[model samples]
Target: MSERSAGLLLEARGVGKSFPGVRALQDMHLELRRGEVLALVGENGAGKSTLMKLLSGIYTADEGEFLLDGKPLQVSGPRDALEQGISIIHQEFNLMPDLTVAQNIFIGREPRAGRVFLADRALEAKAAELLDRLHLPLRPGQRVGDLTVAKQQMVEIAKALSYDARILIMDEPTAALNDAEVRVLHDLIRRFRTPDTAVIYISHRMDELKAISDRITVIRDGRYVETLDTATTTMPEVISRMVGREIAGGAGPEGVRDDRPVVLSVDRLSTKDLLNEVSFELREGEILGFAGLMGAGRTEVARALVGADPVASGTVSLRGKPVRITSPAEAAKHRIGYLSEDRKQLGLLLEQDVNANIGLSSVKERFQSFGFVRAKAMRARSRELVDALRIRTPSVDQTAKFLSGGNQQKVVIAKWLVKDCDVLIFDEPTRGIDVGAKEEIYRLLNDLAAQGKSIIMISSELPEVLRMSHRIVVMSEGRVTGQLAAAEATQESVMHLATLRPETETVR
Candidate 1:
C-alpha cells in the first residue's frame, strides 16, 4: 500500500446505492484520514443520509465497497457495524426518554451477575465509569426524558463511544443546540478524536463546518462533487460546489413604511409558563423577526398569539380591532396561521399527499360546498401552489414525507396561503434545510411581503434573522428585551439583547 493510503482510516470506493424509482447515491466516494473530522455537506435530497446509513450498516450498498484501514469492510446490521468499530448518531435522536442514562447507554449489553440474573448496580457502575472517563456532565441515574436536549445529545455520544468506535458519525449534532451548547458538544468531539479514530460530520450550518471540520466533501443530487480543505476553502465556495451555482449574498428586507397599516398587534402577551409580557406588531407587507436563545420563549410567543398555548393575560388586535383568540381554530377564523418549527410532527401529515396537506386547512371554507367535498377544486389549487412555490415534486399526489425538507416547508406555507390567512407566523422556517433551498424560501417570504401579507418569522439563526426581517424583536427569558430595525441590527447587537435579562435595562 502507498503511504497516503496507509493514512486513510476509511474510504468509500465508487459506492452506489439505490431505491425504488430513486438513485439515492451514485458513484459516491469519500476519504477519511486518521484523527480528522470530515464534513459531508449537500442539499437535503443530495443523499447524505443514504451514504451515512450505508456506512453504519443500516442499508447495504448496491454496488462498490467500503475499505477500513485498507481492508474490505463488511457488516450485517447496525449492531454488527458497532461491533466492527463504527457508530452513527442520527439527527433525530434514538434514545428512549423514559430510561435512565445508564440504562440507555448499556441497554442490551447490561452487565449480569450470572447468565440467569441481571445486575442492575453493575450496569449503572459501568455507565458511571464511561461517563467519568469521557468527562460527560451526566449522572447515570438521571432520567433521559428529564434532561435538556443538549444533555440528551450527550447521552447519544456517550452511547456511541461506549462501543469503542473507531469511526464516529454525527448527523446534524448542533441542529437543535444553542451557541453555548454547541461549544460544549464541539469540545466533546475534539476530546474524542484520536490517531486511531476519525469522525464524519454532516451539517448544513456553514459556520459550524469551519469550526469543527478539517476537510469538507460536497455532493449534489446523489453524486460526488468535490473535497476541499476547510482551512483553504471559503464557505461560499463550498456552498457553490454543493449547489452547483454561485449564491449571491443579499441584504435583508428594506424598511417598512411607518405609515403601513398594522395588521396584527400583541400587547402584554403573557403565558403561564416561559412567556412574560411580550409585545410586538406586524405591519402589512412587513417581516417581523423574533430572535433569542433556546427556551427564551420565541416559540411560546407564537403559540400564545395563535392560541396553541393558553395566555394568562394580553390583548390581540387584528386590523386595529380587538380580538380574543382562544384556540388555533379561532386564530384561523381571524385569518391568522402558525407554521410550527417541528413541521413533520405539528404542521404536515406525513402519510398524506401534497395536495391534501396543501388544501387541508381550507377544506371546510374553500374546498367544500353544500356538505360535499370538492376533490377537483383541491387538486387544481394544490397544483397552482406547487407551481407558484416551485415545490419539487413529480405530482401533487406524491406523499408529503417523500419530499425534501425544503419542499415540505413550502407545502406548509401553501397550506396557510390556501386558507387566505393574512397574518402568518413562521417559527424556524428554514431549520434543517440546505442553503440553496433557504435562498428560495427567503425570496418566497419577500414575495409574500410584497403581496401585502404580514409575516412573523422566528429563527434561531442570527444571520437568517438579520437577512430576512424588516424589524427584529429580541427576547430573553420570555421577555421582549429589545427591538431593532433591519439597518441597525447586527449579530453582536442581537446577541446582546438575546442575553439581556429582565433585571437589566432594556433596549427599545
Candidate 2:
C-alpha cells in the first residue's frame, strides 16, 4: 500500500445498498484517518444511517467494499464487526434496561468460572476496570434503568470501548443530552483519539459537528456530495451541501401585540413531583417559547397543563373562563392539544396509517357519525392536511412508521389541527428532525400563529427558542425564573435564567 493509504484508518469505496423498491445508498464513499474524527451528516433519509449500518455489519453492501488499514474488511454480523475492532453505538441504545450496568456491558461475553458456571465477580471487575480507565462516573452494580439519560449514554460509550475498538461509530450520541452532558461526551471523545484510533460521528446538530469533527462528509439522496474540513468550512455551507440548496436565514419573532386577547392563562401551576407554582400566559396569535435545561420541568409543565400529570393546585383560564382539566380527554374538550417530545411513543400511532393517525384526534366530533367512522370524510381531511403540511408520503394510507422522522412530526401537527385546537403545546417538536425539515416545522408553527392559534413551544435548543418565540419563559428547577421579549432574549441571558434556582429572586 502507498504511504497515504497506510495513514487512513478506514475507507468505504463505491459502496451501494438497496432494498425492495428503494435505493438506500449508492456510490457512498467515506474516509477516516487515524487520530481524527469524521462527521457524517445528511438529512433524515439521506443514507447516513444506511452507510453506518453497512459499516457496522448490520447491513451488507450489494456492491463495492470496505477497507481497514488498506486491507479488505469482512464481517458476518454485528458481533463479528465488534470482534474485528469496529464498534457502533446506535441512536436508540441497545442496552437492556432490566440488567445492571456490568451485566449489560458484558452480556454475552461474561467470564466463565468453569465450563458451566459464570464468573459474575470477574465480569463486574472487568467492567469496573474499563469504566475506571475511561473515567466514567458509573457503578457496575447500578441498575441501568435507574440511571439518568446522560449517565446511560456514558455507559454505552464504555461498552463500545470495551471491545478495544480501533474505529468507533457514534450515531447521534448527544441527541438526548443537555449542554453540560454534551461537553462531557465531547471530552470523552477527545480523550479517545489516538494515533491508532479514529471515530465516525453522526449527528444533526450543526454546532456540535463544528466542535467535535475534523472533517465532514455530506450525502444526499443516496449519493456522495463532498467532504470539507471542519476548521475552515462554514456550517451554512455544510447544510447547503446536505440539502443541495441554500437555506434562507429567518429572523426572530416580532413582539406580540398587547391588544391581542389572552387566550390561555395559568396561575400558580404546581404539580406534586417537579413543577412548583409555574405560571405563564399565551396570547392569541402568539408563540410562547419555553426554555430550560433537560430536567427543568418544561415538559412537566406541559403535562400538568394538559392533565397528563396530576396537578397539586393551580388554575387554568381559557379566555377569562376558568376550567378544570383532569385528563387528556378533558384537555381536548377544552381545545387544548399537546404534542409530546417523544413523538414515537407518546404522539404517533406507529402501527396505524397516516390517515388514521391524523383523523384520530377529531374522530368523535368530526369523523364519527352514528357511532361509525366517516371513512370518506376522514380520508378527504387527511389528504388535505398531507398536502398542506408538505408531508412526504407515498399515500395517506401508508403506515405511520414507514415515514421519516420529519413527516411523522407533521402528521402529529395535523392531528391537532384537525381537532381545531385553539391552544397547542409542542415539546421538542424538531428534536430528531433534519435541518431542512426543522425549517418546514418552524414555518408551520409561524403559519399556525398567523391563523390565530396560541402555541406553547418547548425546546432545549436556545437558538430555536429565540428565533421562533414572540415571548420566552425561562424555567429553572420547576419555577419560572424570568420572561423575555424576543428583542431582549439572548443565549447568555436565557441561560442565566435557566440556571437560576427557585431560592433566587423570581421574575414574573
Candidate 3:
C-alpha cells in the first residue's frame, strides 16, 4: 500500500451475497486506498460483478460492512451512490444515442436559466472543459450516435467525471476498445489517480492490469484469494492465484495439423470498408484461431464468408471447387454454419423452445416431412443433442431464455451439429461463460476436431487463442498481417501482428 492511502477511501469486509441458486460471494474483503487503482480479477462467475453492484448500490450485501473514510456507509440506490461520489461504468454504455455529448454528460442536473429554461451554452462549455482536461478530441456538440464505440466510451467516462465521482468502478472498460483506444483509456486512468479518488479496475486482460493497476486482487469461486502489488508480482503468479492452479503448456489436440487436408479456403476476400484482402485456410479436423483487437475485421471476415455480409471481391473454395455463397441458406447448403458472438441477437430465438432453436437450421430437411413438421423426429434429435452436450435443461420444450449462458452456448453448438455442418465458425464462443463451462466448451471443440470437423474460432482473449488454435491468423485494420503455427505462437508475437497495419491506414 502507498503512503497516500494512510487514510483509506473505501473498505469492504466480510461481504456476502446469494441468489436463487447461487451463492455469489461470501467472506469477501477488499480495501481501496486513495489514489490507488485496485485491479479486481477473477474468472467468469467469480462474484466480481456482485461485489461491484453492492458497492454501487445495485445490490445490497447480505452481510458485512462497507466503510468510506473511516465511517460506515450504506448506499440506498444508484442515485444515492452517485450523490455519495460512487459511480460505475458497465461494459455496455448507457448514453442516449440521439443526444449530444454535453447533454448526455449533464443529463440529470442541467444548468438552467431561472431554473426553468435549458442553458445549452453553459452545458456545452462545461462539457468542453471536461473533454479538454481529459485530452479527448471530441466536441460537446457532437451527437453520441455519430461517435465511434471508443469515443462513446470516452463520453461515458466524461459523464462519470461530470458527477465529480471520487470512487469509480470500471468493469471490462477495454473489452470493446482497440489497441490505440486502450492507450487513451490508460492515460485517462492515470489522470484519475489522486489523493481523494479510488478506482476499481476489473478486466480479464492481464496485460492491461500490468499497465494500469497499482495493486491486484484475486477472487475465486466468490471468495477472496489474495492481493499482490503490481510492480512486485509476476504474471504467472497472479494467474495461478486467480485460477487456483498452474495452467498447462499444450492447448489443444496435437499431431492433427499436418495430416488433415484443407477444408475451406478463402482467397483475397474483401468486404465494403470492413475487410480488405482477408484470406485464410481451414484444414479438416483443425481449429484455426483468429486473433486480433476489437474492430480488426475478424468478425467481419466470418460474416462475409458465411454470407451474413456481402463480399465485394473474393473467391471461396470448399474442398476443390470454388462456390458462390450469396446467403446464409446457400452457405448452409454447403455444410457451413456460423455461431455468432451475440447468441441472443443473431443465433437463438429467446422465445422459442430448445427443440425449435436446435432444429431451426435444418428445418427443411430434418424436421419437415411431406409439407408437415415431424415433431417426434425433432424431439428425438433435440433430446440426443441435449444429452450429448450435457445441457442442463428440464426438457427440450424449455425456452432458450431460461438457460444459463453456458447452456445457451451449448444449444447454439447443438444447432450447428444438428445441421451436420462440416465447417463451423465460432465467434467468441466461450464469452460470458464461467470457468468450468469454458473448459467444457474447450473439450467439445477438441472432440469436434477429433471427429474431422474443421472450426474457425475467433476470440479476443489471447490466452484462449493460444490454447485452442492449431494455427493462428492475425488481422489488423482488415488485413491479414501474419500467420503463425501453434507451436511457435506466443502472446508477444500475436500482439505484434495484431498491431501491425499499412502505413497509409488511419485508425479511427
Candidate 4:
C-alpha cells in the first residue's frame, strides 16, 4: 500500500456516500501524484462526479477521509478548494458571459486602484500573459459567451491557474471541441504535467485516455476497481474494467457495419462546413452510426438534416422519397428528430417540467374539445414515457433542469419519441453518462432500431462506433474520406481517416 501510495500528493481512501435508497458511492479510493494525469472513468451514476465533488468540497464524504499531501484535510466548497490550490473546470464553465476573459479570470481578486477602481487594463495584461503561457490564443478583453467552446474552456483553465491550483479537475473538457481545439487542450494538459501539478482528467473517450492519461482509474457502481498505467494497458482492458465484462456482439454499436438496410438517404449534400457533396443513406431497423474524428462536419450534416442549420445545397430522401428540410419544424413534420450536442442550450427547456418537455413536441395533439390541452392525458403519456425510457426523476412534474445529464438526455429522447419520428439523429447521445446508463442507452438504441426506427448516430467514441454501427462513415476536414462495412472498420483505419490531411494533398 505504501509503494502504491508513494509520491502521492493527494489521496482519498475508502470514500463512501449515499442518497436515500441509492448508494451513490461506496469504498471509493483515488490518489493523485505530482506530474501525473489520472483518468477517472465509470458509467453514468458510477459516482465519478460524486467522488470528484467530495475531493473538491462540492459534497462532503459520508464516510472516509481525504488526505492532501498525505495529511488529512477537509474541503468546504469551491472557494475553499480554490484557496487550497485545488480547482475544477466543469463541462458547463462557470464564467460570466457578460464579463471579459481577464475580468472573469481574476474576477474577485481584481487589481484595485486605491481599493476602489479596478485596473482593468492591467488585469487584461495579466490575463493575456496567462493565456500565452497556456498556449491559448484568446484575447483577454473578449467576452466569455463570445468565445468558442474550446476557447472558453481555455479561459476556465487560465482562471484555475490564477488561483495557483496545484490539482486541476477537468470534466469532459473536449466534449464540444473540434479536433483542432482538442489538440490545443491536449497541449494544455501536457503543460500541467510539470514537476508540481497533478491533473485529474475525466472523459469517456478511451482513445484519449490512452493518449493523455499517465494512469487510468476505473470506478464501477461507486467502487474503485483498479488503476493501470497507460503504457501497460489496452483500451479493451480499460473498457472491460469500466464495464466489467467482454461485450458480446449484437448488431454492433451504431457505428459498426452489419447487414442492415439504408433508411434515410442523403444524396449530394453540401453544407457551410466540411460537408462537401456529402452523400449517405440510413437504414430502418439498424443503428447506423456516423464515425468521424473531430471537425469531420458530422454534426453539421446532422444540423443540416434537421434544418437546425442551413444547407448550402442538398437533396434528402426519406425511404427514397425526396424531401426539402427548410427548418427543424419542417424536418419534424417529416418524422425526423434531431438531438443537439448542446442539449442544455438548444435541446431542452430547462425551466419547464419533464412532462412539459416530453409533450412539447406533440402538445398540439393533446388538444381536446375547444382547443384545450388535456393535462391528464399529457401527464399519463409522460408517465408511460418515464417508464419506457427509464428516466430518473422524482415525478413527471420535475423540471428538466433538475434531472441529471443522463436523465435529461432521456427526456430529450422522449420528446422525439412522443413526436413518433422515424429518423432520429442522436448527436453524442451518451456524452456524460456513466457506464451503466451508457449500456442501457445502447440497449435502448438497439430497441429503437429493432422497431424499424432509423437512427443516425453521431459519436466520437470508437468502441461505440465499432460495437453499434452496421456501417461506418469516416469524415475528415469537411468531407467523407471513406466508408467501411463493419467487417472492414478498425480503430487504426478509422483514426487514419480521422487524422487531418492538407487540402493540397490528393485522396486515394
TM-score of 1: 0.90
Off by over 4 Å in 3: 1-6, 93-155, 178-180, 225-246, 251-259, 292-294, 322-333, 342-420, 430-443, 461-467, 482-508
lDDT of 3 by residue, 95-189 (tens): 89899999998898889988689999999998999899877778999999867555777888788876778998998777656566678888888
Tens-place lDDT per residue, model 2, 1-508, is 8888988999999999876555778988988999999999998778887788888889889999999989999878899999888999876567888899999898898999999998989988999998887777799999998675556777888888788888999987877677887887898889889999999999889999999999999999888999999999999999999988887879987999999999999999998888888888899999999998877888889989889889999899999999989898999999999998767757889999999999987888999889999999999999999998878777898888767666788899899989999999998888777888789889989999999999999987888999999999999999999999999999999999999978999875
Candidate 3: pairs in clash? none
Query: Which residue segments of model 4 deviate by more than 4 Å?
Result: 1-8, 11-36, 57-65, 70-76, 96-155, 161-163, 177-191, 194-196, 206-276, 317-322, 366-399, 481-484, 492-508
In TM-score terms, candidate 4 sits at 0.78
Output the lDDT of residue 403, model 2.
Answer: 70
In what order do the candidates fall by lDDT, top score first?
A: 1, 2, 3, 4
RMSD of each: 2.9, 2.9, 5.2, 4.7
Cα lDDT listed for each candidate? 0.89, 0.88, 0.84, 0.80
Cα displacement (Å) at residue 456, model 4: 1.7
Ranking by TM-score: 1, 2, 4, 3
- What clash count does candidate 3 reach? 0
Between candidates 1 and 4, the lDDT winner = 1
Q: What is the TM-score of each candidate against the true structure?
A: 0.90, 0.90, 0.77, 0.78
